[model samples]
Target: MPRPLWAGAISFGLVTIPVKIVSATEDHDVHFHRVHLADMGRVRTRKVCELDGEVVPQDESGKGYEIAKDQTVPVTDEELEKMPLPTAKAIEIAAFVDADTIDAVRISDSHYLAADGQVAAKPYTLLRKALERSSKVAVAKFAWHGRERLGLLRIREGAIVLHSMKWPDEVRDPQGLAPKVVEVGEEEIEQGLQLADRMTIENLSGFRAEYREVLEDIIAAKADGKPLPSPDEGGERKSGEVVDLMAALNASVKAAKESRGEDHGEEATVHEMRPAKRTGGRTAPAKKKTASSKTAAAKKTTARSTLAAKKRAGTKTAAKKRSAS
Candidate 1:
């Protein structure tokens, strides 16, 4: 087990469980240190005062909120600490509700929670057992880093688990992103649902950590001084704009079945809007990749016909290529 980064006592109604919060997740994102442009040397940043041009002392600095362009509101650590303290420090138990009631978007990250020592073993096991037997999550609140966070504590695989949650207002309504969720035809939605059901993979073997793999490849390629991959229409090395939504979806379904080995035959989506004719009048097949290729083999794919989609495609291409080897 990794060393615990934080040690604290979980507090609730009357029970205090001594526990340690360990670094639960490890991020493998490829990162590069900042470097001087001309010399290509590492660039280190420090907290230097603009007026004195010297590193500032931690005790001399404080956090401030900007009220206006030049106005500010100052808060002291002592005053901030007096506001409120969450009763339960260790995994607190509140009321448990049906898991289906909570939307998945509300969850952020999950962490494994374990008792500190042999002393907490019995109670921890009992709590986990109760939660598992009832098949309900404890909707509890925890004060983390001065902010009170809504979290759900549950039992998974005989162990306690926690999922941090977002506030109700944090999630945006879907109505603003499109015309109207109600305006969508029932048949079209059903078709989409069916398509999704068919496309969902039941086996883990079918899934790939392509993003991680691609990033690693690119890093190796760059270290070896290999040429960067080109940005072609993401496929067939040809570029064209999509004109219709429903048509594109239909075309994709057909193309997938024809070339991508799509199984489970999906139901076709029916949309009111149709795609416009290809403006550039180009027909190009994506470049084929060989085993000796230094760049990513699969092309970036997107169905969104907006600028965001284009930017995302570019990002995916770059990241994929960088990690690809």
Candidate 2:
């Protein structure tokens, strides 16, 4: 059980539902501390006052807004807490909109909006069910972490999930920062699509963060006083300027098909029926098969034959049993 970060009521018209906000996600990245390399001792940092050159205790610190190079306006925690803000203790519903209309880029963080108590459960359930039926989300405003935040409340897995959003001004425009546009030929585009089709997988879980696993292995080896293993060399990729796009795409499709235990030599019926582009007088080059592809095809053929043999044997045994009866 995790503790709630906030306890408040969600207000929409006359309806007020008390809810507890809990974090919906957690960090899994590896963290490291600063240490003295020679002595392997931990390193610590301290805050000191610039005026008196004295170390400042945590309690002595205060927030300040710098107006000029040497001028700062000090603000107290009590004064900030007493500031007028309607969303300080309540989530005010601003509007309702289709959940799909919300851009993923605007979402910052997510939190679970759970009913605070038994008294609030009925209203919470009502709200969740209504959102599900309408496929709508509530745009809301609330004060959290000492600042006003924009959020969206929607039903997720039978519970109300709140997604903190970034204001329009907070999101940076990529007009000038984006990559240079590259004009792609129709043949190149078709080949690229074909390669993508070959590499597509229904489940994303098939892939893992292999580098993290390698790092863990290295750590384990050090703890056990074993020699570190050599890093595996990655396949060489041709530079964009020198590479033949169509050839690369064809090779990639062939490799992908072989990895999936499919025949690389046999043309896929779909590809034959729907030629990506008309070659006119020129015919497309034959796919160049690698040694690995040949080995994969042979294994697949052997497996099919073995399965057919098993089926035939099972039928013969059943016929024998029927004759005996």
Best by lDDT: 2
Which regions of candidate 1 are displaced past 4 Å?
A: 9-16, 50-53, 65-84, 181-191, 203-206, 227-250, 255-325
- lDDT tens digits by residue: candidate 1, 1-325: 6456445555545766666665557664545689999999999878998778999888988877899987889988775667656533445656679877988999987776768998878777777786788877778777666567787877767766778899899988876575444466676666566445434443567566666555555555565587654433554523766556556556655554434343246553333222222336532223454665533242221111232354467777987787785
Which 10 consecutive positions of candidate 2 have the poorest summed lDDT? 269-278
Candidate 1 similarity to native, TM-score: 0.66
Model 2 vs truth, CA RMSD: 15.8
Among these predictions, the greatest TM-score belongs to 2
- Go through the candidates in order and give each one's C-alpha lDDT: 0.62, 0.76
lDDT of 2 by residue, 191-251 (tens): 6776666565546766855565555455555655867756769967655657666565656
Worst 10 residues of 1 by lDDT: 298-307
